[model samples]
Target chain A: MRSFDGVYEGFRAPVSSQKRSLPDSHNPAVNMASVRYISKVVKALLTFDNLIWYSSVKYVLRRCEEMKSGGAKALLSFVRVLVNIGWYAYLIVAVVTIIGIPHLLFRDYLPADKPMPWMEHQPGYTITFSDAVSAEGLASFARYGLVLGLPNLLIMLFILHNLRRLLAAGIENPFTLENARRMRIIGFLLLAGVAAEIGVNLITARFVINNVHIPGATIRANPLPYRGGLFSALLMLIVSEVFKLGVLLQEEHDLTV
Target chain B: MTIAVHLDRLLVERKMSLTELSERVGITIANLSILKTGKARAIRFSTLEAICRELDCQPGDLLEYVEDGEQPS
Candidate 1:
């Protein structure tokens, strides 16, 4: 295994050299001190080496190096393809959400007598409806679909666009200011997505309560617990700040002679 | 911004090219060029000492502090 001694030597080798040069004294104390120092140095070197090998920081740095050298071009290309797939898939879904939701109002309502598959297992309360859905109820549902789905889809489209550009730039140099800016935008959009989700849920929940009706079922619409979305947004924001700092530091390092 | 490098002047006075100085000082030409063009943010003491030694000049001869609006001497 490669050791960090070469790099560490450039930082500090004088102390180790001086310790090695201690005169050969008969005192056991001196011998013990030398032994202890050697052990400590060896431990430090091993620990440093292990950290370099095992740390995710090493992985990220190596990945960045690979990106800069075009070694990860194939992987980036693959990711770009996946992002493209997601971009178009969401686009189709967005179109369906827009067109299909309104179209549902015109379709024949579900059989008024038949139990809804979703309501079949209601344990205590029997779900009974006079009409499967009224025109107002269907219209509210369509409105909810558009209100919730469109913003999320648009945010995702924006995020994907930024990610595609970021990946493309990463293939050349991932350390540019523009890349950092793109990352920041993506982070904010992610945060906005979470907020939009909550907001839309609130709006649609109100609509559902006012417009939706059933005889025995008390319908309640609750906001989804988007913990993953929230966590990812916060993480992306932190990473963007770190990336910005790294880029600034890299600039300073390059300018330093 | 206030500390102006006199490397070009010193190099000319010493009758040495930047390449010759870079070779003697064991610094890359690109780095020396950065220093020459006044684009370098900071210089290592070791690099400064090496350049001074090769140029046979004091640190003050290679570096001068001027006011923001004043032209470099």
Candidate 2:
């Protein structure tokens, strides 16, 4: 937390006798690696399973930080590459799912002529829409996709943008006003996205129950009516405020020192 | 807001430059400027001790409390 760690080292030692045993937070490679690590942590915040894979990795990083190991940067570099690649892979998967869902959902791949064996006891006849304007199913799918996908997309972009700023500050200057503002933005965005999703889910369920007519039998709509994930967003907002206070205190400390 | 620093007066009296005081006290010149310019939010005991030791003065000699209704210092 103290950038003052080695300041006294240089002061106390004779210029020629000074050994360069310090955190290389200034190196471009190391800064970028830290950025990557922070980005990975941000991405991991959304997921529990992904964290399982990184549990050992995180512990190792913490130990390295504790030991002040200069060589740990090499390890951080490797982990940075892994986290960067994995995040891209994850992003690609989400994008593909967003694009592919409608393609698969609306296709006449299942013949509308008669219900396939899976439709047995299920009330809907397979209806294919030539155009989305006339078909309720197409409308529902498109609405659901936009409602669900857009918020998630926005939240991801916003968080990544904020995390980039935070990480670019590196370990020394993490408590900048810019980073605090970004964190606050991220917190608000997460809250808004989650709120919008829960609201849309209820609306979507209702739409399905009412508009998705399958020729008459009991058609049940599984409308997941519960809202969730507010606690995490609330916690993030609190953290953002703390960061703001940190920025203020950091300014005072800077002036003091 | 009412507290004022007389670091310049002390430095003048001691015939010591801010940079020399900073070097002797093991603090940066920028921080010394903060104290001299009265922009510091607070001062630490160690820093005060160092400054006091360097200047051969008491804390009260370098610091003054002006009441809010007092004329501009």
- Among all candidates shown, the one with the greatest DockQ: 1
Q: What is the TM-score of chain A alone in each candidate?
A: 0.56, 0.52
Model 1 reproduces a share of the real contacts of: 0.82
lDDT of 2 by residue, A57-144 (tens): 8977776675576564555555555556655765786677778776655543322232223222323355222332233343345545
Candidate 1 DockQ score?
A: 0.57
- Could you report the DockQ of all the candidates, in the order they appear? 0.57, 0.39
Q: List model 2 lDDT by residue over B1-73, tens digit each.
A: 6888999988888898998999999999988898888899889999999999989989998889999888535
Residue B20 displacement (Å), model 1: 2.6
Query: What lDDT is reached at residue A78 by model 2?
Result: 50
- Cα error of candidate 2 at position A233, Å: 0.8
